[model samples]
Target: MKTILLKSGYSIPVMGLGTWLMNGRECFDSVLMALENGYRHIDTANAYENEDDIGQAIQTSGINRKELFLTSKVWYQKLRFKDVIDQCHSSLEKLRTDYLDLLLIHWPNKFIPMNETFKAFEKLVEEHLVRSIGVSNFTINHLEEALKSTVLPIAVNQVEFHPFLFQKELYQYCKEKQIVIIAYSPLARGKVFESDLLQKIGQNKDTGPGQVALAWLIKKGLVVIPKSSSEEHIIANLGALSITLSDQESSMIDNISENQRFINPSWSEFDA
Candidate 1:
């Protein structure tokens, strides 16, 4: 598996298994399948409400904790100092791990003071509960505030990224700040099937539309978590690890006109 080194000096596999809406035995099996299929990174969150299932899967997988780069998030409402610490410990117990490779603030909560949340994170890192820290669904403005206020480096900003929602400006900002941009919904929740450009590229590359979308982002050095329940899909999604996008193909994808976001929760500060 390919890895991206965070500014915090921790390395994360570029491809991860995202568990959003995956529940019960399905979520359990998917995580095991990914790990058994050589996936080294896994992304989950407290908001997903499947951490217990994931915990069961990880414990049974028999993979050593050090071999996996596990990531989980504290929910937006839990950004308060004590809530952040409690959520992480809860996640640790549910995920059946002593520590997490990365812990993220699930979303930006303007009502909570950034200093309090980050101060908690700084303590988490100092105490070795989480090796690296970041935020998800954070806009450039939010990141700017975090970068300015946090004593520890903000290592990642995961968000909805795909051909349809090409966030060029945010991508550039993250690159300049040495922060990794993890692309969630890289397959756009099956929206890649409707993209003519992605389909054409897949055809030329002798692959599928989903693989084309993932390969396009991987080519740009972004991390991606495309969720799946089928072992077939899990293995197939990893095929993008070998697929390469050329300069022209990359630019063509960049030129895609649609900018629709598929996962816009009401509390999401996507436009901020």
Candidate 2:
């Protein structure tokens, strides 16, 4: 797998497995398959309520912990400084790991003071519980607020990013700050499977439209995590690494950006 270098000098896999809605034996089996299929990165969260399953897979896979890049988020509800630290410790215990490759604040909520939350993150880094720290679903304004609290740069800001909901402004801002943008819902949550342009591109590449959508994001130099519980879909999603699109083909897909978003939770006000 290709890798991207973060400003922190850590390299992350260009593509990863996302465990958003996955659970039970389904998540365990899928994650094990992903590890066996050469995937080295996995994204999960506290709110997902599947960390125990994910930990079981890792423990059973027998893959060395050093080989995997694991990420988990602190849910918005735990935004208070003290609560953030306590929650992170709980996550580490559930994940069965002493250190996390990356830790992120799941969402920006008005109820929590950004500085207080960030201070907790800084402490985590200082104590060596987290290798890197960042934010998710943050706008430019939210990012600015986070920066004001600490000198440790934001390593990444994950958000809803697909051809239909391309975030050009936020993308540019992250680029200028050297912050990697981890794209969640990179396939538009299966909506891209029906796109005519993606279908045509898939046909030309002799792959599925989902692979085309993933290839498009890979070509744009963004990190993407597409989730699936099926072994067939996991294999097919990994095939995205072998395909590349031309500049014209990429431009054609870029034209399809209509600012469409698929993962809007009730608390979020930012429109991707």
Candidate 3:
């Protein structure tokens, strides 16, 4: 349960349970398991269509709201000012919370103006509906444009990050801007479990390869959220907190293939 300091002066858990591609009772059961375990952070989004299930999990777990850190996002299609405002309220309603610990723009909408979206974000913070605001899937240029305005503090940038998709420049830019880099898909979508190198490293540490990947990201000061529906994987993923990578091992992970990204969409502007 270590924490990372955000620019907005809030502390976020270094490890979180990512609820993506999970729905209904499965999502509820998974989240309940995570909370029952040592997890204090939970990540969901409007695009995921499972906020209600997540809310149900939270309500049933009986964990106090203040004791948990919940993060949800407004999807790309909902990037307009009006949509942003409405969606924030919708998300809050579905989450069964008066406010979100962190609210993020799910994706950069090339068609929408950044200032307009941020203005609504500012209003949310002003009204105490959101503690902090940030973006997801934002590259360096996207963040630069969003940072141009003095509307609000961009607290975090969650992205597809792992040894296979290591975004060095984006990571450094966020670091220099005091923006927390939240690593979604930190295990490379179960692909990390296939790598012999990761396995060897995990063997040295007496753990699994996925844990090795998580440990590497944690060692680099990045917050990681790896999604899992299985209780076994959920418990195993949390075990990553105990695995420490050597400087050399960290460097070894750094040199792994970086051309893979699991969550690419047709509308994504990754090359631009």
Candidate 4:
């Protein structure tokens, strides 16, 4: 797997496994498969409610803890400074890991002061509970508010970043700030697989459309996590790390961006 260096000087695997809507034996099997297949990064959250399964997979994989880059997010309801620490600790306990590679605020909630939430993150970093901290679904304004509350650099912002919803403005801002952008639905929840352009590109590259989508993100230097429970799919997703997209092919996909989003929730004001 290729790696991207974080502000903390630690490297994150450019591709990872996403554990949303996965649980029980299914989640455990999928995670173990991913870890055994050279995947060093795993993205989960407190809201997912499957940290114990993830923890078991990691323990049984026989992979060194230092070799993995695990990430989890705190739910929006836990945005208060004290609650942030308590919730994070709960995640740590469930995952059976003393420290997290990265921690992120799941979403921006108006009820909680962003500054107060960030201060709690700073404390986590100071205490070494989390190596690096960041946010998800944050706009440029949200990021600015976070910056004002802490001296510790925000390492990355995980977001919905498929070709259809490129989020160009936010992408540019993150680049300028030297903050990595982690694409959660890099495959657009399988929507990208239905694209004609992606199919053509995949045929030419001797890969699947999913791989083509993932390759496009990697070519643009963005981090991606595409979820899958099938071992074959896991291997195919990892193969994307080796596929390189040409400028013409990349531009073809760029022209297909429609600013479409698939993961918007009632709690979020983000509409596309």
lDDT of 2 by residue, 86-200 (tens): 9899889988998888899998888778888888988998998988888999999888888787778789999999989889899899999998999999989899998999999
Q: Any runs in candidate 1 off by more than 4 Å, and if so which?
A: 269-272
Q: Write the per-residue lDDT of candidate 1 for residues 143-225, one digit (tens) a residue.
A: 98999978898999999999889999999999999999999999989889888888889999899989988988999889999
Model 2 ranges off by over 4 Å: 269-272
Alpha-carbon deviation at 237 in model 4, angstroms: 0.5
How do the predictions measure up, each by TM-score? Answer: 0.97, 0.97, 0.97, 0.97
- Steric clash count of candidate 1: 0
**C-alpha lDDT values of all predictions:** 0.91, 0.90, 0.91, 0.90
Rank the candidate models, highest lDDT first: 1, 3, 4, 2
Task: Score residue 203 of candidate 4 by CA lDDT.
Answer: 95
RMSD of 2: 1.5
Least lDDT summed over 10 consecutive residues: which range in candidate 2? Answer: 263-272
TM-score of 4: 0.97
